[model samples]
Target: MLRYGDYTLSDDLITKITAVARHDDLVPSFVICQLCHETALGQHPNSISAREDNNWSGMTWGYDDLDPKTRKSGVQVTPGRKRPAVEGGYYIHYATVEDFLKDYGYLLRNGGFYKTSGAKTLWDHARGLFRLGGAQYDYAGDGSNSEKVFNSYYTSMKTIHDALNADGSLDRIDKGESSNMAGLQSLFSIARQYLNEQMYGSGHRRIVDTYNGQNPLPVGYKLKIDDDWCAAFVTAMSILSGNYALTGGECGVERFVRDVFQKKGIWLGKVRPQAGDIIIFDWDANYWADHIGYVESVSGDTVYTIEGNSGSPSAVRRQSYTWNMWQIKGYDRPKWDYASPAPLSVGGKSIDAIAQEVLTGARSYRIKKNTSSLFE
Candidate 1:
């Protein structure tokens, strides 16, 4: 129960905020912060439009009034000015809060503010929203102008953001609950759900492959899918499971194994693998992964995995493995919390869990030589 001004934060508001954030792939904290700025968390007298007209984001009224969805004409009077008798004014009105938030999401998404500069942080998104409204202030600037008067509006919204984060009210949105995936359940539940769907075979491959295909290819990307689509299935499952940002969209097994897994340090030798870990395999022991799947369980020296493209129909199945199993190239584990029946250790000769390896390998090279040994 967040309290600000005269407004008590409701679950309905949170749900609408979450919906907009997920739909636009933006952070919900920033969206709500912007809403706080716009409506003053129901404090600003002008924000009465939210309750009276269901207009929450300062949207303007249209020319025609025939559409029932469009409510009363919006008006925003200055502190000293009286409300005009005309049917329209500066702000927009809506029939419902849902319509208002949905339109705000559309503005953020289709208006090119989110795409061009990117909204990676709460402040970045807030600044983007401010820019959308033609505000010239810096996103990270102190809340003071030349008059030395603090901008209470901006400072107040920022405080709201800080409070939400400090109290963990923003945790749900931060953890992808806006995307319907949150908590420890999210770390594995989505993948398990896809596995239960039992999507398998080349006939059903299109379902996952087409989903993975939505990602735009980088410039000069030439490799295309033509054969076994195990990687595609894995990548698609990750996207559908709401972990696409973590698993990535690589359709090639070798690319996913080397680029996504190894590059991110999630790649590990099949030592003490756990459930929710992605198992990549090479059919020929050539160090080139040709297939991938999710680890289901581990019993003694045997490891079980749910893999797509297993049998002749390319169906998904759980395969068991013994010690030193061939085709068991390595495992790629998501850095998330899950129910691991076996205890995970960090070091020693024991098969320590291997998901948190430090980032290594040089990003660039420079030429240097010893001056003292020039004669030698």
Candidate 2:
């Protein structure tokens, strides 16, 4: 089975699709979703478009009588006549898979579809494609009931995206051009200094003192002078190391650690090991993660870690463990948002209000084309 996020393509079609998309400058996720909707990833074994014409995107056959250069035709099949057949009418075809993608990309980019709405996310782009395809779906305002089906599509794609990301498949799929774990490198750099700092005295005092000076106390709890400083040490290091986002605003290690993984949708045993991941330990293998550390590195059969509470003095120590170590419960990889999403709130105005302001700024499309409306 081939994976594209969390969903499995169960075939090698995604490999070719990704290649074509990357080379053609089309968003891979959007194209994949369209293919999923159009042809079910070519899982319809007896599909006429898949078997006869190698077309899986349902591009329609066209002939321009006025201009010979505009003529484009495909091997047509009637609705409901064959497996994976179009329900409404005859559909288009292509000679090869590459040709299908090339034509589809060209049409999507040059046609009024992509030109109309400057969509940023894959879901929004899918909305545009749905509109262009005359699909019965609305893209306005988080999509109402008519467009609620779009949510399923978006959820599936996001599942796939997150799965692929957790499994580190995007790096391999993108030919190592993008590494999801690249953001963790800086965290390791920041944590490198305290690799072997031994805590004197009660050890908890130093940790609490260090934490208070750097940032304000977290919402609920005030730091006790002699509390177990392991969690506090981890939290302080995180804030100092520029990974404040994953801290989860919790003073406790277990709570924040769980929060990081849950919020990121990455669970233990679901993701591959990468440096700078937060490693929590279950000392007695009782399913309770009590101790936490930063993943230093992973070798072939062993994992190296830099932990805060190692000895009685409570000094940071570098430790190594084999994969079968019972104390190792699991690891949580920090979710780093490299690209911020579009601002939903702008200058204290709600997104709806801002959208209205935007709509008021631009004139509505009124031009006519081929007895239909020409979108601006």
Candidate 3:
């Protein structure tokens, strides 16, 4: 709904970009902002890709992994008008704008560096622009996580993300149709659909892990990927259910609590939780929140939950806890409105939930710094 009414980039092209990027599970707005940055809103002199090839985002055709995916070898071209490919070939020439977009989406989605560069979330990508600048080009070759570099690229994207989503509205946020329980029921239902789900090294959860900029268990490893991904699952549920605006996503629980729940004023401390509240627990009663899960329902003194990274083999499963168990730290509730439940999966892809990013040590350096405010 962003009125790109002020830009010269045609609505058709922008629309195509959105459709293609989203089709591949890539965030389209970030892709659009990157295109604007690289091609000067598709008006740069070096953007012959934009003019002739319809490669509006400066995609090069040199990587071997990406080569086999495309039908053609690509057009021989140079970085600038006067320059030429060192030998005779290597810049991608699209047969159609569709071809270019398909390859572009494939590159970003499967590309080794984009996710690590923080491509999962728009602001996330700003952190590792050195690797992300141009995996082949290494645009920020100095390898500095400098504010100046971020200011240049991310600031431009910020200018475009409706002033950085100022006022905190997200794209898919739905207003309540009935009561809070209705939306909470929908959230629980969406999560319930994925119960007994296996934790695999490949699939939607693994992909979303990279998108979140968290290193996920690699495929083909000897181990069965038993890493703790509870928080990732919760975060993914938030996104898949269109509740991300209410339930902010983060890889670490400490960060989720301190940065999101607490910062957003959603951290309801030590209060009895209802269904749909995010519950935090402390196994040791040492004051740091160690585990997180969603409240399915509260029956008497027991709280049912759908937690990722639960049980013996480690998978998405349902469990119960005493409502006031010492391990039960507190709850953070999202303000929900009524709506129908979203499908647990999309296009055979989950897009966001069910991966438990490892909890290396919640009581480590991070929580040590943020513990003062919780009990206060």
Candidate 4:
């Protein structure tokens, strides 16, 4: 199966989509999501827009009269019936895939895609599509109760967007292109460092000290050696791994889910998870989440997690569970771009980041001959 973000697409559609989007100065991830929503990534069962006419996204013909001068208005053709979401007037037909992609990009930019609300994030662009997309998107086309339509559209798009972020599919698609594997590697390394440590006993000081010393946690908060550390452990590791920007900082499971994860748009509620995601467990089967941990790996239906406060005395240990494990509440999945060039609160700029800046001429370090020190 060919994959692009959370959903698998029909034959090599991602390459063409990304190429046209990048070339046309459109957001690739949003374009991918729009395509997936419109035509199921060029493979909608009852729709032959992509297969027959090279139309990926469900771009209907603008009006009865075709204007060849308009960059977006391609040849109009009567096409097969599609799902209600995309059912509309005459569909645009293209002679080639390249023609369709290029026209799609031109249509979005030159069309009525106004009011992006800064367009900083995927959700922002999605909102722009509905709110300001009267001439093209048509979400508010019918007119009455447009706010209700927007909310419903946003909720559905959020699910698609969140899944794309969680699986590292949007890793390279996001702005600045952070490395997801680098962040995962750092978490694994940190977990390995505290694997054999004891909890709540006389020997628990080391892990506690290491966490406190290493992480620049926000003021007014610090953990005791024997305190409930499951949440602390995950947050601290996130901070230390240079993912503070993505994961944020939180000490309580419920607070983290509601405040940090959901607030930042990385919380996946009751969705199938992948490795390197944070898992919450409620042993009592209550909606209140009781414990937290990060997934170590996944094999078929089983999920392996390395957790703190798991045993009788709550020491760090690896445990395995089924995919539908009863104790699981939800997940706190980080976006694939964990080590972005954006500011990381836990630590200053990393060597890799520094090197990138220098290469791009955004930064330069010079040694002071008088003081024997350097500044960038």
Candidate 5:
């Protein structure tokens, strides 16, 4: 049993997270874990700086400083400080914990931190961020697997959570419980209890592709198409995986990449591309940007993609594509905002119906409105 002063380790953070979570009615533990993982308890100088300036991660403009507010904070790197720096190298700041929690909650809700709603429980969200989502401290280019990285972060988080939970420290300090094992179970129970009222109140189910004989979409679904297949593939995959949003409208490939930078404030181009990052292309030879694909693997200069809506039949397909063949347009980062999954509605009908509407123009089957609600 771990303890932090009068309160248990898990309890203290849980109370802190809950104070903010109430506004969104989501789990605060996940956010707390992420902050701990990202800033190392605000001990890192970069985290302190970034937090003060509303830049959760230290993403600076190259040469030119954009955003007058951030510019005033001196957010840009000092130049020639090496490509990537360690711990305090990337920091974003906020004035108060309330502000920090608000931004943190926003990131968890709409910034692409998790799959669309219900699919990822709070625990999964916390674990995922600690795993491959947050800023990478080590840049040695060691070929360690993502699973290994996840386990390492998860272990550290568990230790912190345990310390917070030992004697109900969080509850006494901030009137909330821990968000680890015991607390997670409670959250799931609460979510299930309010299933009918929540947007993604229904539980998440595994999406199956019936066209491919009910097969799960390949980890990196790919296919070859004559024209630009990048955008189509992203839209197709989102629908196939039940991650599409009809209300905010389906975020196309280019929009998706831009959103990662704009909405989430993540600096994808500077970071090393990982397995799930989206890779863009200038397929049409136009500078305006044309296509995109999810990176499946990268060996030397050759990269593979799990593309959708490409090749004959125009269905979700997988095929080998060369990295060199396409001009590099930067990486499409995943932010994993699952807390407040966007409501999908078009023409006054449910998003599922709208998905069907869009799919008619697409080569794949679209989700149907009220088709097998999962949570309830």
Candidate 6:
């Protein structure tokens, strides 16, 4: 009998993939399975190019090319371009796995294919690949008639998932050694705080307070200063958690983003959005960004955000407001150099309790330190 973790390559790959998925608040097993099917566990490096260019299923290039009328000269042909090129057969290439992962995460985050009723979870994402009764699989290369490819991918993913017990259950081979419960909880809690700050005011601390109260500012509030809510939230969480800072700031949002981006193997400079990533936006139309938000969720054509000072009188608030409007001007997700556990106060009271007392419905308690500076 083959044990679930028998395949070393698949197991290790799945572990890495799961870490990525979990960090992105996605289902680790589902993403691993899908990628396994798509990349054959990196056996087909060309598949990364395929995904980049044609969005093909783990394969490079498409079967057909564009006609000459549609073709334009001066175009770059990178990689995975089929021979006897058609009019618009352009080659694409990904320089590294980091590049591929960023693009892949962007696709999954913004891909319309995953928004349909049939594709809510990572499991749905996998099954949706075999839509139309399995007669046709989306993204699968043409002339590849083997259903075994998908089966192998699915089986391999299941094997990995069973080994890791990635569903937050106890089926794992190592008894959940790989699960980062504390890390995940911290991330989630920080994300919630980020949302609250964006919609209401950073001054507001408690989630319950923001949920119950009216807008923090007056009805006709207009913000004078623009603070990068996303960056500020990240910094606040990092400081509270006692993480190391590579750069100086009031807290350390930029440093945190930089560290996390580097640590997670994600490219730091980019315009694409990833789920749970702190997205910075330049509201003043200047090249230098002045605003930021956490990607609460991504649905086709709609991105749910948790930002600070989005409302009038741009200030920190407790509740998070959802905004579908606004163009994505810029983004940054930095890697962390080191993550130290947040120190426990001698009193031993939970952070949540402190935040509640500071933030909850006690509008008087929530104080606005400085309007122009994110550090405040």
TM-score of each: 0.40, 0.44, 0.40, 0.47, 0.34, 0.44
- The lDDT of each candidate is 0.52, 0.52, 0.56, 0.60, 0.40, 0.40
Candidate 3, poorest ten consecutive residues by summed lDDT: 367-376
For residues 1-376, write the lDDT of model 5, one tens digit per residue.
Answer: 2233332223333334554454443444545545555555444565545435544334333344323242332232232222245532323334444455555554344333432122134346544343244423221124267657666656666666566646654343222222222212222222222122211111111112211211232233432223333354454444443443311112245555554334543323422344444666665666545555555555655666655444554433345555446466666434322312323443465544544433333223434332211110
Ranking by TM-score: 4, 6, 2, 1, 3, 5
Residues 1-376, model 6: lDDT tens digits: 1123322233334444444444343554456555544544454555544444433233233425543221122232335544344544444444445445544554444332332123444445554454422323443434264455545544655665555444543233112132233432444454454443434443533322222221233222322224234444444443333331321122223343444444544423343343544565545555545555555554554556666555665544333323323534434432221323344232565645543433444222111222211111
How well is each residue in 1-376 modelled by candidate 2, as lDDT tens digits?
A: 3454333563244544654554444556566666665555655554557556667765544432212222232222223223233344444455456556655655555343343123456666655645433433343233445356656666766665565557655445433122334335544554555556566443334445545543334554666765656666676555433355554334566675565556654344312344556777778866666787777777765778877767766677888887446677776655532312123244665434533432333212221211111122
Clashes of 4: 0
In model 1, where do residues sit more than 4 Å from their true spots?
Answer: 1-6, 40-46, 62-91, 110-117, 130-153, 178-376
Candidate 2 or 6, higher TM-score? Answer: 6
Q: Candidate 5 at 61: error in angstroms?
A: 19
What lDDT, from 0 to 1, does candidate 3 have?
0.56
Query: Which one wins on TM-score?
Result: 4
Screening candidate 3 with a backbone cut-off below 3 angstroms (N, C-alpha, C), the clashing residue pairs are 118-125, 120-211, 176-337, 176-338, 228-356, 229-356, 229-357, 236-352
Which of the predicted structures, 1 or 4, would earn the higher TM-score when compared with the native? 4
| Candidate 3's TM-score | 0.40
lDDT per residue for candidate 3 within 1-376, as digits (tens), equals 2333343654345545644554455555677666666665556776775767666665655554433343332333333222155644445556666566656665565354455222567776544344544453343325465456666767776776664245432242211011334446545655665677667734324424432532222222222244567777786565545455567667567777887898866676775556777999888888877789998777867889988777866677889988877888888867664233344333344423321221111111111111111010
Task: Estimate the Cα RMSD of every predicted model relative to the unseen true structure.
Answer: 19.6, 21.6, 18.9, 16.9, 16.9, 11.3
Candidate 3 lDDT at 25 equals 50
